[model samples]
Target: MTMRAALCIWILAAVICVGRGHAIVKHQAEQDTVVDSRANTASLVNAANKEFVFRLYRKLAAHADSQGKNIFYSPFSVSTALAALSVGARGETHQQLFSGLGYNNTLLTQENVNQAFQMLLDRANETTRGFINSGTAVFVDNKFKPQPEFLETLRQSYLADGFNVDFTKTTDSENTINEYVKEKTNGKIDKLVSNLDPSTVMYLISYIYFKGQWASPFDPVLTKEDMFNVDENTKIPVQMMNMEEELHSYYDQGINTTVLQLPFNNSYSMLLLLPDDMAVLENDISRGHVTKWLKWMRPRRYDVYVPKFSIKTSYSLNDVLTGMGMTDMFGDRADLSGIAEGQKLAVSEVVHQATLDVDEAGATAAAATGVGIMLMSYRHIPVLKFNRPFMVIITERNTENILFMGKILNPKME
Candidate 1:
């Protein structure tokens, strides 16, 4: 690889190796704060800006699906990275966001970004600690925070890498942030933060954009009782979306692995590829043959039978990430000196939680629970179908940040 490319790879490797030790934000425990008002107010209205973010979500979803992992993805961090960029983020921001996630490298300013990192230091650390205690099986996991010194490294790297430097606007941090979320999720995600307390040290914002249709929409009326193979002795009431059709890349590989794809109304859709006999599907997923299979397939309709499911997954990402290569930033060797002079600073952690309710109303019926409830006219129905082994991608109209991508081999078991 060329020097620049090599440098990029090294930066990413360092992040992967060091990311696990960071912490989670602490304010999330404030339940009485009220979700409706905080997430649905007028102080933050950046509609056109939000649409732009959605484009990124779309791109990310497509790329993840292409990579072959049964993806249960999120681009919230990516969106935050972009937001940081909008306000002139530097190297640390890029490292924390890109390196931490295994996405392509991005460059930004060092001093400015480090300052921002310093601003969020305490909360970031807490987030990491939470992950260490919670774990990934919970579904929603927090992304780690970078140490201040690490943020400096990120800034220096970006400058060294020839990244375009742009001035940031902090005039209305809240408005800009919400606007970005709106655009990223096509307005599906709005008011990620409400009533930003200037005194509040750490503020986290995510944009979840999804647009997928069922391989076959369930007849709202014909929904009947069926045995959902959740496990050997577990079967429950499920609205089965049924359709018999031929698919482009259907796989029935050995080891009881089965893969299938269901296209959404747009370029995206839901994918459900399952392992026939594996006790746990994640093992099959971690082995890594998904990207190759997805890339070499065609897009065709198939007859599918899927059950409607509502899943809530919350996780603290410390261990899984530590296991994934981000080790340095966690312990002693961590270089977070930049956050505070002579002060021992390390990224505490990240905690991410997501709840998905898929039904005949549409693929991303999530909007009903969010901003869409108010803007009744702009609401798009959600379509939920779980039939063959398939993949699901929620991408924005432009940009590389994919909102969410993952395969539901068997929603029954998860």
Candidate 2:
């Protein structure tokens, strides 16, 4: 493996890893904050940014269906990493990256994007919420010196650091990168790179780790084996956790879907969407749909039951990204001169991995694992049971920034 060839892998993998997320941003500016106003450029920019995230999510979700597997990815991480990469990107490269990142505020320039993402990194770093540790790092061949502009932009925009490494020693290099990911994710992502080619010159990586508890705790004793209806004809036994909490929820009778908010330790919450039929799960996952769910919701109490499940998924986004109009960035036509001052570079691969563990404090696992929370019955209080497929989201209450999300066709499948 040539050091040159290895650098290609490093840049793509690291940047791609960054396009992922687990670190949740704190509460947004303010509730009274207009969704979009020219004077409120930050607010306007943020809302506009989510449009792209939701669009990307839909595409990735479809990919999950193609593989017949449960999946999750951190779009925030990916965006942050890409923002760092865009430091030296010019022309079409910058255009594609910005478009993919949902940066459409006409009033905001590319510099504004750097500032916004930097602000988010700072917010997560300072937040007291459940562990949200995020950072970016760039490792380069000692023989090559990165330009001041690239390094400074990366440091400011993504809170990134730089290091010199021996890419020729693929074993040590691979182990080092994997170790870094392991530590950053609290060991959730242990082996991101199994083998490193010797031709690498520089590699950059972005990572985030999150662990939060529910505001309401579930009763371990109440957890029991229940039938999870994957479909009309498929049923599997799963460890179903329960709690009786006086939580605010919205039950849409028209769609036979329920929206319940499960608060986390800090300012984060899990907005669960339980539908009556599995067929409707994909149709209702858009940002607009979630916004509507929140608007239509009023406080209600129910005997809530949810499955205790853990899912880990990985994806190769090279094709999807190319399909998303990032062709030049990955091909010879690429112009990544800003990074090295005068050198030409192109990305070769983009791999992303993620894990989701929904085990709260008190709820017991089917194989003896524990989870978390609420209310019930007179003549008969409403019972909200997730004894089937459901969708869940972990987000910051303040910003409504979604950190993680997934659809459970069958908890047992994971």
Give the candidate number with the greatest lDDT. Answer: 2
TM-score of 1: 0.47
Candidate 2 total steric clashes: 36
**lDDT tens readout by residue for model 1, 1-414:** 211100001000000000122343336665764433333221121221233233332333244222322224343333333333323223354354334433333322333333333223222224333211110100001222324443344333121111111112223545655565455344543554344433222233322333334444544554555655544655555667554444545454544555555544434434455565433443334312444455555644444456776543333444444543445444444443333234333334433334344676456563221111111133343332444444443432222123354454455533
The CA lDDT at 134 in model 2 is 70
Alpha-carbon error at 197 in model 1, in Å? 13
Write candidate 2's Cα lDDT for 180-296 as tens digits: 777766666678876576766778776766666566767767888898888779888888888777787887776788889887657777788887764465655566666776667
Against the unseen true structure, what C-alpha lDDT does each candidate score?
Answer: 0.37, 0.66
TM-score of each: 0.47, 0.85
Best by TM-score: 2
